[model samples]
Target: MKNKFLLLTWLLAVPLLWGGCDKPLFKTDEASIAQPDELPPITTTGEGTFACKINGVNWQRCGGGFLQSSIIGEWHPVYKIFSLQGLRSCEGFDDAVYINAFIDSIGLYPLEAGQYDDFNLECQDVLDQYFLLETADNWVEILNLNTDEFIVSGTFQCTLVHEGCGDTLFITDGRFDYDWAN
Candidate 1:
């Protein structure tokens, strides 16, 4: 009777221990970036949508916005700024991408519509915070930029170098259309 009880206890505990040891399905590799070749090509139709390929995997923004900020205190009338951001999600993970553009005389900020050798594009993910300004290998192009209607659109391709792990994420076919609130 005692031996049977011990055997039954071991059987139940073994499965529980094994199940608790399960690892995450999406793992970040230190030596190489994660690449998913099966993802479909990003849409480039400019239909007021945002999509991008991050590390070769499809990432689409569920929501995004354009915001403005102004320097207060002594510089109240001297400085006003605008910023654009998008949030991309995959497998419960969210990546936030941001762009800060140059402000105009009329307090309107729009992305520069042209190929840029360097820019201030930034991205933050679970693994790392990546930046385009760290290396000269990254580039961005603004296909369309309009501030009159409070809309800004663009396409970009960049190699975001991780700040902590030294890993790299290749972002390609990146496009966005941000409509700011009045």
Candidate 2:
């Protein structure tokens, strides 16, 4: 009888210990945004940089470019077209942040500074993939967009949802300035 009781207790405790040892789906390091003095000088040589806070942690990318997608269809006043991607892929994973937006058209829509636009922002790491949660509320402000030079700059903030991990990551103070052609 004593042996049986000991075995039963060991079995229950083993399962509990194993379950308690499970790790979190995602983990982020604590980091702060870079100040103006810390930022690299803006380059005119056509290289672009993207920087943002991921879950309050700082992340930046030095490789990416801007382009426009072909017109898919017409939406009357404004053509229904997608701004081609300017993406920065995260190291060690098939994840990236689609950073900039460029509305390409003849004279239908003028690229205006300080205009807030909804963007399909995405971020993924090894563990999970995240996308913009509130499409309408989450927006990026165009700081500058020069059609002739093909240079664009912007700032953004959004909440990203990871369905697989059942978690959310808030990205804030996002900024990108890139000269598309080099």
lDDT of each: 0.47, 0.46
- Compose the digit string of candidate 2's lDDT tens values, residues 13-109: 9878767755533433122223233434433333465556666665554333322211111112144232323343323222245432335432223
TM-score of each: 0.54, 0.48
Off by over 4 Å in 1: 1-7, 10-12, 19-48, 62-82, 89-91, 103-128
Q: What TM-score would you give candidate 1 relative to the actual structure?
A: 0.54
Candidate 1, lDDT over the whole model: 0.47
- Residue 153 lDDT in model 1? 54
Q: What lDDT does model 2 reach? A: 0.46
Error of 2 at 95 (Å): 3.4
Which segments of model 2 are wrong by more than 4 Å? 1-47, 62-94, 99-128
Clashing pairs in 1: none
lDDT of 1 by residue, 58-151 (tens): 6554433422211111111134344445554433333465545454333333332211111223333343455564444444454444544555
